[model samples]
Target: MSETPAASVSRRRLLARSGAVGAGIAFSGALTEVFAGTAAARGLGDRGYGPLVPDPNGLLDLPKGFRYRVLSREGDPLRSGEGRVPSNHDGMAAFGGRHGRVHLVRNHENRPTAAIRVPPVEGLTYDPAGAGGCTALTLDADGAVRSERVAIAGTAVNCAGGPTPWGTWLTCEETEDKAGTNGYTKDHGFVFETDPVDPRRTGAVPLTAMGRFQHEAIAVDPRSGAVYETEDAFQRPFGLFYRFLPDRPLGGTGSLRAGGRLQAMRVPGLPDLSSVQEPGARFGGVEWVDVPDPLAAGTPIRLQDFGPRGITHAQKLEGCYWGGRSVYFVSSYARSAEGSAADHFGQIWRYDPAGRWLTLVVVFGPDTGVQLPGESPDNICLAPSGGLMVCEDGGGAQHVYGVTRRGEVYALARNRQNPGTEEEPEWGEFAGVTFSPDGSTMYVNCYTPGTTFAVTGPWAGQPGR
Candidate 1:
């Protein structure tokens, strides 16, 4: 399925308002100053709600008048009696439920060696040997957990996934571990669909057509039912951004299992996304190359041959979300010292499916300074107020940032809880960062020690909205 000519025309008009095509396209002033590749963009300044106030509880630090509550912890027993909560909480999505409640499906990026595993549930277990999976949480109107259960079990490294327009979660496994590599099991590294409302509807099946690799996150286009995915491979060959066109478009539940065609993105003249340094640099005539072997029986998709014009690849393609008729994906830093083509802290790209155009919306200059607002944005989501909420996965200190449409950056929350000593403080990276349908509360996760938080404040009164 493809977008209509009217949609393409609409996108062209939007681009005209932002800036014309190519290397000097000005964005909505949402990233101009912050991504100017200057020393000032690397410094910490007041931009969002205000300066973050330190939390006395030694957990999450937030701005004045804003507060967060711990909804789930690593060792807590699930209300559904599905065993203790798993560790290494990662990607997540929120949905509206009965009686104004919120339903959240969260991924557990667990390796086989992790102490606590997502308890295998009947009919929902994919492989008994795999330890990583997903858990669904039901919260009441006041943002308190009412019930929690295992949504999908026996998957490996369930890193991140996207919520479907049909009200389900596409959980992704971030591993290529073979059956015998770890233990008794099956081949991992595939996408699995989970139903937040009913576990029986999930069926614990893997969407093989989505391709097998170091899958990170995905964003689905509601109009065309196209799935855009990201791969978080950190090796020499790196990862390729993928698009999956399902046989069934917008078919409600259990439709992905019917099969689909998978393809990797190819930018005409660019091979590596990190090679481009200028903000607002746009690449036109984008193409998609079919992946011959979606199952990856022999070679990984990124290392496969896509004719003489090879597919484009990036170092760490992390967060992805759909908004304003475009697919926004992130590359969480690259370095020449680390064998990359060039160096940069982070990059946020906007892909217009209608026009087949890719634009660099934000780029964090590689200065190695921890104070930068755009430092290593991992999981991202579009706010109701036309801003971007960024979860930082970088060093020194961790924070959840809010970038206004005018390009101003502000600290919404900071991770004050460190698991290590002061000399070697290890603050876990913030993941998830989603909001309720009513736009009232924001939800996020701490990757290490496994904790979920519900934040509520004067979101309506927040400045720069």
Candidate 2:
């Protein structure tokens, strides 16, 4: 497969199509009301193809005209004869394939003791002892699974990753474990590239230059080939947003392994992103500090002192994607109760690499209640219909929320499977949200039981399509 650029579009057009302009509104602008107010009062009645109807089979709830097909599930036999499918599906990416098919590279956030692990394929296994890796699934033109196989193996806590312009998935290890910890034979927190089309091209080698830390997700700039990554650290000192400038920008497959420079973002006086409570807060002239120790052999990258200019950090730094010539990242949530500087339900930030400025695009109020329409946004991807599809990792129920340019938020899909008893229902968080290259199908993963679904519906009728 060749390089596949992100779904880039004109910002002005995208905003206009979504009805964000001329109204002094931005994406997710009405999020507060959408959650706090009633459905009819919030104008969601005619939005998002109507409210999601409960699924009869107790799997996934979708709009009246929308239906989902189970692509793969945990414990399922692989077509490649590589044992059963792994668990803890997280981030993923979709690429175009021949004969109207779509190729998906999914992450398995498993540990060393996972019951079912990505089979350690000979050359693809980085460390046979590691249980977390990635699997590639090919879907036919009709959205049926054509083939399934292990793309990479022997990695730990493969949480989330981004797609490269060269049509490959960058699987990130959300860990800082050393070789001695948990029986790991090698240091495991690094980014590895996987080719969905040709596994042979991906040697399962770690991209050491990308830094070793708790990586959540990454988004690659098609223009500069610069990769923006998020760190999902929950403890004190939190996580830092990083940018990797590759030596060979846009150099197709296996180029990131060549080398790169890693740097952390610093906003003059702002240290923790959670402190910013209001939307449209813009910070200009932001600076990047070089990471002295990308390998983190002694100290983690976020903990390393940058001298006089301390590195900026945020709590629960998650989803990231490159679109509209800017890199968008998310801060899932922060709380004073958790040692964070401030509190907020969620925040979506836009960073303009060209201008070296950052803006708080969307900020969800401090609503801890599970009734919020959208909360704890993770694994975000730009919707083909001019907005965004956010995977919810919050409490209560789990949903894939869709945000239009008009800032209307609606539940696109809800998890109907309750792992807990009927009296105490539990819904798994949705992750790895992505649309097919043709924009006909939306692929998302349920993290707990590790189920992947391909949703098809009246996408063209979407508000901003």
Candidate 3:
């Protein structure tokens, strides 16, 4: 399928007309009175895919004719006859495997202080002190687990990463904690490539050329082999969107280690574009500024280097996906108090390489509740049926929302795991929302109370279509 270009004003108009704006309206120069007429203007009071049917298992709530099967959970014995399944299930990628099977490389976002750890395995670990790594799972055509094993170990905070076109998962470490300070022998914050077909081929090499910041996720451009990375750091020294232009096209393996030039994004004329504008606001004349030192020797790359170069900053840049020849990324949330020009519930940005223009496609207004269309979308996946499945990471009830090509929003699933106590019941956020190669099954992870589920339903009959 071809990419939806930034110049496609028709798509934006369709999104605006489909009530994709949700309860929150677009923010104008003034935040208070910005979305006053948005709900009425778009007639978006009754959005979403009907009502969600409460699950009897109390784990997840879904709409009618939908259900999920628990494929794996923390503490489950590994099929490899080694360690148990690690905790803090995070990002994952599913690939078509041999014999009509599917292989998934899942990330464990465990830190040194975590209770359960990804056991240190010989040749599969990076730092012995780190507990974060990845696991490989093989599922049959019916989505039944055939085998599971530790793919990589001894890493730190394997938060989120993207799949390469050549059939490998690039797991990213979402931390910059220096080695020797936190009992770590080597540096943290680096991306590692894993081969699901052969766990033995999984090396402990770090893609240092991709810069050393709190790397959140990556999306690779198949046409040019350029890797787009996102930083999840939030503070006075925020994160900048990065592009790693490899010296050579990425191939079977070890191509990332060949070294590359790391560059940060700079929108000319809008140097300080806070990304807090209304939905459909387009920014032109985008440029890429070379980072003198991608290694960031003893200095934070975002604050010390890119910040000084006038690189445009984003608030908590998270999941990114390559689809339709364009790279779509998420900025969890931006606010004036957080150094942004205006306050926004969340923002989704699309970068069109063909036009070299960055456009704001989806923007959540000031409604912080999950009952709204979508808020704080973290990990994103493009549906095979031509829509976007976004995992919401927000304060209220967490949900997985579906955004149609025309910008209609619908609730696909909701977190129903209750702790039996009164400590804010629905707190777990959904992560690793990905579809199988054939698009029959969808897999996702619940961050807290870590559990991985395989969801299958009438996806084609969903509202996004």
Cα misplacement distance, residue 210 of candidate 3 (Å): 1.2
Count of residue pairs whose backbone atoms collide, per candidate: 2, 0, 0
lDDT of 3 by residue, 243-289 (tens): 99999876658888899899998886564445447666778778888
Error of 1 at 40 (Å): 26
Worst 10 residues of 1 by lDDT: 20-29
TM-score of each: 0.89, 0.89, 0.87
* Candidate number that wins on lDDT, 2 or 3: 2
Rank order (by TM-score, best first): 2, 1, 3
- Cα lDDT tens digits for candidate 2, 193-294: 999998779878999999999998998989898999899885789999999999999999978988989999999899999999877788999998899999
1 or 3: which has the higher lDDT?
1
lDDT score, candidate 2: 0.81
lDDT of 1 by residue, 1-465 (tens): 011345334433443443421112112323532333322233232256777888989999887888889999998998899899998899999999989999999999988888789999999999999899999999998788989999999999998899999999999998888789889478999999999989778778989889989899999999999999999885778899999999997998888888999999999999999999887788999999999899999998888889998889898899988875788889887756556798666788889898999998887543322343335678988665446688877544677877765665667888887888989776777898999998878999988778999999877673523
